[model samples]
Target chain A: MLKKVHCVRLDGDKAELEDEIAEEVPLVIFVNGKHFSTAMISPQMREEFVTGHLFTEGIIDGPVDIESLKVESNTAKVLTRHSTTFLESRKVILSGCGSTSSFLDKKKLPKICSNLMLDRTMVLNAMKAVLRSDNFKRSGGFHSCGLFNESGAIIVVDDIGRHNALDKVIGFGLIRNLDLKDTFIATTGRISSDVALKCARANIPVIASKGAVTTLAVEIAENSGLTTAGFVRGNKMNIYSGGRIN
Target chain B: MLKKVHCVRLDGDKAELEDEIAEEVPLVIFVNGKHFSTAMISPQMREEFVTGHLFTEGIIDGPVDIESLKVESNTAKVLTRHSTTFLESRKVILSGCGSTSSFLDKKKLPKICSNLMLDRTMVLNAMKAVLRSDNFKRSGGFHSCGLFNESGAIIVVDDIGRHNALDKVIGFGLIRNLDLKDTFIATTGRISSDVALKCARANIPVIASKGAVTTLAVEIAENSGLTTAGFVRGNKMNIYSGGRIN
Candidate 1:
């Protein structure tokens, strides 16, 4: 999603120009005829983001929990086979990259168990493939995520938020009944604790990125038995946990 | 804040190394002894972030609206003169950079009115000053925000979240009774609509960044009568709204 806008370019002298900017929309999620959460994301991949977000948020166990889901414009209506008790007690307003509700508690997190391993070439290639997103290259404002196995990159998605991109990727895999434990994710955003938590909740084996990682993210990944690789640039990368790279 | 962690660096061969990652902590806000919201932020500048956040969220008009504020370990206790009715009706779980509650509505936003002007050198210097944060330079995971006037940078703060950094900067100005309308902000993160709304609400005249801008952000900036400069590089930048740069 790119939007053209008129702007003034300033160099040694001012020059008028038109530039492309990434579009962000507010997607409100309604669960069982009630408001659940709102996420700011790119216009593409709305359904995938909703499914992945619900699963990662622990609102749903899997895709089967969702009876029906419809996304019209900026609103997503989801009918799930669960009570609304979880929604009543846990209404939190999370600003920025912070989610300080039940998910932040380490004891409540799910432990990832998998035997997935990747070679140096595979890790580097995945990072490259994700970084080569057309939306990011065009607008320079979108974060990208890619799901990969030993074969190659399977599904790649971009969103205004890095968390949304990863959630969309996971949702795509869940709908297709893919073995998430056998797949890894490559992202173009920093591996914060929340990002690491999403990967752990999704049961993804490895989370690789061409960005930096936070201290809490490393601790959570180490505790959850998930591998984290950051700074995956040309010919170099850092493995924070789950030394599953050969 | 940086934490030393043992990690494996993979180039052609894997080598063990010690790396520094940024630290993130959950700061739970309690208004009138009641839980308000929780934010994930860097450990430093808790008080400034709290004050700025309350003002930007429209919970308080200024620093005087707060009777007392105390920040302990990870909890910030704020006693406001206003009733908690606003908190009861508006509880939203914003997953990423989305705040679809009261703040996202453009009609409810405060239009910025200021005569602040900056030269090309001033704009470029502010961007450079903000980007030269030691925390970001060391860990490569912290987002930085700087308050600037025509002379130079005033206050610079770094946080795990960009929104937190800006809020800390605003709080610093508020506590010092600085005229926010006469100053501007420079950040090291993408300019999103929520960020632009924060500046508009705070009456900050200009927002410049070395990162990209979203389409919604540009629209909000234009509507709020604020100036937005993006891609502030060596000798060039793009002006999206309120052409206040000479």
Candidate 2:
């Protein structure tokens, strides 16, 4: 998902030509033959993307719920029992109830009931592991994610888009039937309410990031009973929500 | 769309609980009462977002095409003559052409024919102006944009989302009837293909950023005939595409 291109580089009054770049493609996803959404992403691990998107968006419970996922060029056709149901649900929710109502409802989402605990040192190491990935070091365009537990970051993935990286990690978990409730998610993407909602849906109790945590994400994390930390640089971090951190 | 939140700060091994955060919300757009897409955005510039989104997506030519924009709570109702046409076009394109062909078609977008030239010193100053904004200095969460020309940065806007920031700048231009072809866009967000496409649609020839540029963005800029540069920092930059820089 990359391409070599000649670029003019300027540094401290010096100029030189070089070749480096990662390709990005617009991937339009269709659910049950209906258009869902479009994302500019790297053309890889698309099935994981479809599965992760459906599961995290509350469209499906797990990867088993996806009947099929077919990629025709840049488009992904995802089939699931709830494919049409999810679309209808979005329409009903949007047309019937106001957008703010839905926002409030999600904000008041059920608390994630888990007893997961994370060590500061371990989480810092996990953040370091994500930062050490070739994708981050090379492209600087990709987002990275690592699923962590008491042991450490067990599964790691990267994608052109931040949300896609998290989705890939969740999809991996769903396929492995991992106990998500006890899992902690470490990522290199800004933590938004969308990310918080996804973690809530997956029953993830802790989320740590090497980036900033927006206000809504913090609120969602606090309300949903998830522990979230941001700015995981070197040995420092900020826990935005939940009080279970040690 | 901001809220106050209490947070726990950790430096190395020390921790302190405090308050510091900016809010985020989901803004759902409806055109002619039909549900469009939902965006996670800062709520300040809903109308600009609607107008810019329409203009940049090639849905409407400019702000003159929009008849009205109404915000009821968190939902934006945009009224445009091309609303139905745009929706229909998306459906037809997605269903009829599939995905890959459309992707290729966009990738081969014609070169921007504008002969606008930008000086390195002026652009570096523009980037500095964006970084000096209160939004960037205070929140550290908002993405910023500054519309520039021969003189310097003219209009600057900030939002939680990078796309929204660019939209605000474009909407500002549309309302004031600015000559967009001669404009240079300076931003503090990653220049993805979507962003490149927006500049192409606006007939803008120069896009400079203090962030990374994805391969797709470079390709789009190169194809769409726009001069694009990234990693504009302290007296340095890398021009990925186009040759309109002096």
Candidate 3:
């Protein structure tokens, strides 16, 4: 996940330094033997990312919808039980942080109905734990996400893209048959509308971030009945919507 | 570019606080009367973003390739001198931070050829100038990019997406008929492979960022002859590729 490279450091004095950088690889997904999309990822957790990405993008209802998933090199071949007509019709390439092809209709999103409530200390600890990764600390180029409950973090993933990280965590939960509604997510990325929408689509109740929350994200969380929290650092956090925090 | 919202601030004592957040809107692009893509942007500099995006995505060679560009609300209607066959044939949704449709063939990318050299002071100053944005400070959700020469920052743009911010600055330079080969870009986001490719596509010789650089980004910069610098914090920087800095 990390590659060492020689760099010239300019800090009052010129010094040659070796730095570790995160690796980014293009992961191509094919559905029903047709090309779907290609994502530049951190090259780990390919199956989880593919599974979570398909679910979050609304391509598949759940993991059971996939008959088989095979990852060869950088390509993921997914054979689903459903037809490919839905994929062909909705080819709209939607862009946010990078470019996603998911067409997000706010009204169509399912409102979260989980009764999961988190305390201030738990949220802060989750944020801290999710961010505690050797890859991120070494490379400083990865965004991290984790699924957590009152006990601790269940699965933590680090990716070059925050969206991919969250998707990987969601996929992990789906594969493990974990109750996603009873869990919350903590991330190192901003709580954008897309991020909030992903949690809603996955039926995750709460999302806390170590960054700021966008206004559209706040609105979507409010309408979707999802709890959104941001700035989870040093015992301080701002709750944007769905006051389920204790 | 910003919106005010009510939130619950959680420190030691819970208090109701009014906060400002960055606005994200979907900007749909239509090329030659065909639906191209939709980008979630910060709702500013729509025209510049369109121009820069087209060029960076290799949709148009330059600003002259576009016959007419019209923006209504969030939709960008572009009439190009070229045929839409290129768009139809290459419908691959390439995802990095989000989803982009550009098929990036590293061998096909144009090698940047420029004699632009920068002193340490100038590069550091440019990074500082570009990051000095009121929107980012207020909303804390903006990724900023700037086009700079020895004189200082020519144009600085802030968006929810770093790719959009860089594209906006590139578009600004394209419209003004500026010599992009002589200028560089400064960004507050990480220097990923897509970003390095964007600068190379725009014929920009250098890109400096106050963040980390991916390994693929370093390879792309080195191969394309583009100067890539990262970790441009106070009084320090790391030169990853193209040693054009004194």
Candidate 4:
């Protein structure tokens, strides 16, 4: 998923040639033979991305909601339960590149009823693990996402887009039938409303990151009963919503 | 149009409450009274966003191509010379959002044949200025985009997305009829192929950032004859393409 490219390194008066970069590719999705969406993503995790994208976009409920998902070179064809009826409508263009869905309804977030409490140490460890991943450590061009329980990070995924990282981990949880109600997510991107809302829709109660948290994200998380935290560096962090951290 | 929100801070055992979070809003754009695109943005620079988005997406040629632009609370209406005919087609979704458009063509970039030699000091200073902007320094939620000539950063824009920031500065340049041949862009987001291609299409020869540059971005910049640089910090930087810097 990562690649190296020749580059010139300039450190003040000294200059050297090196190769250290990540790979990005355009992946177009066709739902039931109809063009749905196009994403510029890291070449890995196509299936997880499709499942997570479909679920979060409200296109399909879960992995089982699809009859078949075939990923060819840079393209994925998903046959969802709603494919035929959904394909009748026009393609809805979403706002940004992380995860764009025309079906996102922020006002109608699914109620998440989880009593999960996040441990600061676990969150810190998860954040650290994302930065320590081979993908990030090697190329530093990917965003990392970690799904954690009470103990620690269960799985970590790195993607070119932070939204896709969250989706991959969440989709992984959904596929494995993990009890997401008892789980939380730690990512390496800013806490935007879109990110927080994704966790809310996925029923993941806690969203932690080592980046800034937007006000809309805090409001949505607070209303939707999701814990939002950011700037999870070293031993300090800011909790924007949900129960106060001890 | 930034807003402040209250948040909780945690540092081990001590906790404090603060209200220092940045605001984010969804802005939907309509071209010729038809739905064009929707974006989650910082709420300012809607006109610039629309103009830049239309131009970058190949919807419009420049500011002159737009007859009028009206921005409501959370929506932007654009009347472009090609809006009527363009609205007849379907909406095309692009990957990752800073102002994503369906009309971007990467393989056919406009040739940039400027004899501009990037000044190491100028790039360094521009990067620092973006980080030092009040929006970034205060909220840290906005990505900064700066357009620089020989004098210095002529215009710097802060947006929730790096792509939007780039569009804003470029849009500003277009509206003011600034000569882009001698200009460059400095940003605070990773150098993706989409980004590098946008600058290449806009005929901006130099793209600098304090973030990682992807492999595709390097290849695209190299092939498009645009200079690319990344990891621009305190006293060191990485120049990926164009000319070797001393």
Estimate the TM-score of every prediction.
Answer: 0.93, 0.91, 0.93, 0.91
Q: Please list the residue runs of candidate 1 whose C-alpha ends up more than 4 Å from where it truly belongs after superposition.
A: A87-106, B86-106
Per-residue lDDT of candidate 2, residues B149-213 (tens digit): 88887788877788888988888888889888888899998898778888887788898999778
Q: For candidate 4, write residues B88-198 as lDDT tens digits.
A: 223333333222122234445567778788668888888888788888877778898899987888988888788888888888888888888899988999998778878
Q: Tens digits of per-residue lDDT for model 3 on B1-246? A: 998899999999999989988888777788897767667788889999999998888788888999999987778899999785443223333332212213344566679988999998999999888778989888788998899998898988899999999989999999888999999999999998889989988889999999899887887788789999888999999999998887
Across all candidates, the chain A TM-score values are: 0.92, 0.88, 0.92, 0.88
lDDT of 2: 0.77
Q: Write model 4 residue lDDT over A1-246, tens digit each, in one string.
A: 777667777776755666667777767777887677677778887888888887776688788789999987777888876544443223332333222222234445567888777667877777787778898877778898899888787899988889888888888888888989989888888998778878888899988888898876876787788988888889888887887245
Evaluate model 4 with DockQ and give the value.
0.45
| Per-residue lDDT of B116 in model 2 | 82
Q: Rank by lDDT, descending?
A: 1, 3, 4, 2
> Taking the true A–B contacts (Cα pairs closer than 8 Å), what share appears in each candidate?
0.65, 0.62, 0.60, 0.59
Q: Give Cα-based local distance difference scores for all models.
A: 0.85, 0.77, 0.84, 0.77
Of 2 and 4, the candidate ranking higher by TM-score: 2
Winner on DockQ (2 vs 3): 2
The DockQ score of candidate 3 comes to 0.48
> Least accurate stretch of 10 residues (summed lDDT) in model 2 chain B?
B88-97
The best candidate in terms of DockQ? 2
